[model samples]
Target: MRCFIFVVFLSSVAAWSEPFRPWLIAAYGDTTNQTDRYQMGNDNTVIDIYTNLMWESGFLNVSTINLANKNCVSLFKNGYSDWRVPTVHEIQSLLDYVNAPGINEDYFTSLPSNESVLVTSSSSLQPTDLVLVVQQQTRSISSQYPPDMNVRCVRGPQRTAPLDRYTKFQYADKNFVKDQATGIGWMTESSAIWFCDQAVDLSQVWTPTIKALFSLFNQSNSPLIDEAVFSLPSMLYLGSSTPVAGENGYLWAIDGSTGLFQTVPLLGPAMAYCATVQLD
Candidate 1:
């Protein structure tokens, strides 16, 4: 009996030690110069790990979106000639705000210190000649009419798990939904009454609502559910990177604005999307 129990314990330990998900791996096709993260490939190309996308590190002064698209196709890199603009989501994933260049510095080595704006694959929200401009370092997604933003070319299929942004589930007789890609759990029926245009202070904006909601969730006397505290999700988590509008649309974000990020249609269109890290 003891021997049987010991073998079971070992198996459980091994299972627990296994990796939960695959992390970014740097390789020759995705890296160069024998360096990690990303390295400059031959020519002006750089291989990034996360999206498996080849990027042109060159910054250009293009006149319009049409010209930018043409510029990418005209250039050849590393014996290949397939290049195009990166999507808003792709650009968002590349941004590492903690890092110096706000991207992989090894690959994109010489980015300017001053604000560098880049054009995305998306068109204007209001359907003008304007296009979305992604600020290189910070989380700013503004629009520029006449399309004056710089262009960065990317070529590769986007990799993401085949799951809904929010997968609804039931636990302890209460409703919960988890963001499949990010593993953030949210209470389905709970939300706050926050308007987008309302100017809010940094410390107090999302705090009181979060604490109140968490307290409410904890009040449910269910033995199966514990640690029900919830917090607000970052703009990135709530589909801020997505360029197009859909049924599962925008949520109030802590990023993307100078002071109190505002959404369109005042408060009517804006929705609350509170999320919390799921504990095992």
Candidate 2:
């Protein structure tokens, strides 16, 4: 009886584990046209071939919020003038969980150990005036006034040459995936978890694009499309397996949770995913 019970328990656990699989099955490829995958320019800027973004090699110590805003645009690096502070997601992508400094050390050699807080352009949920900040050492994030924070400027892919003509995807971080083909990066974690067919609540947080789309028609529908920085994955992007109860824990798709093509809820507790175009 004990052996039989153990076998049943093992079977139940196996049945319930909802494993995640990426939609694109092809192994990520290399940059076709770039001379090197990573290139350091004349100034303290480095280019990322995978995501096609240019990053400042180190953090800039700005004591005040006004300075942080003005710092990036004021300087010309490598003859490129269009530099802006990175978004919260963009800065977060630099963190490497397996390594110290949480970023790729090879490309970014000038990072300072004392500068812990990096300011982002994203506003926080609480008290909308505050900006988001990322803690480098702890890999934690908080939203606060940016009176004293470091600023790192970044620019989109360069126009000098073709970075890559074909589509490829690379893991920016555990939570984010970068697609070179579409030049879009996706967030893996869902905002909320729910069963299929649950109605989305309208009062929760959502990007303006998501809010507008959901206002029209949201259902277990077909032919879904993605827009802007934050939205759920489409059912088409979700794998072909139908979500099984007690298995395949629900994630908000482009529709309400449906077995087939669906859109994500505009506002709901359903697990939400985010996507953004690569700066380049």
List model 2 lDDT by residue over 1-280, tens digit each.
1100000000001111222222121112211132455678778788765445677886666666557657766657887776765554345445542346645667775345444554443311101123545555444444333345666777662211124322333333324444443333445444333321232432222221221122112121232222332244443333211221222343222333322223223333334433333111
Please give the TM-score that candidate 1 achieves against the real structure.
0.50
RMSD of 1: 17.8
Runs off by more than 4 Å, candidate 2: 1-37, 109-114, 123-130, 145-147, 157-280
The segments of candidate 1 whose C-alpha lies over 4 angstroms from its true place after superposition are 1-36, 109-111, 123-130, 158-166, 171-174, 177-280
- Cα lDDT, model 2, residue 95: 53
lDDT of 2: 0.39
lDDT per residue as tens, model 1, 9-122: 000011112233322322201112334445568887877653366777765666666666676666577876666555554454455533445556556644454555554433
Clashing pairs in 1: none
Q: Which stretch of 10 consecutive residues in model 1 shows the poorest summed lDDT?
A: 3-12
Superposed by TM-score, candidate 1 places the C-alpha of residue 223 at a distance from the truth, in angstroms, of 38
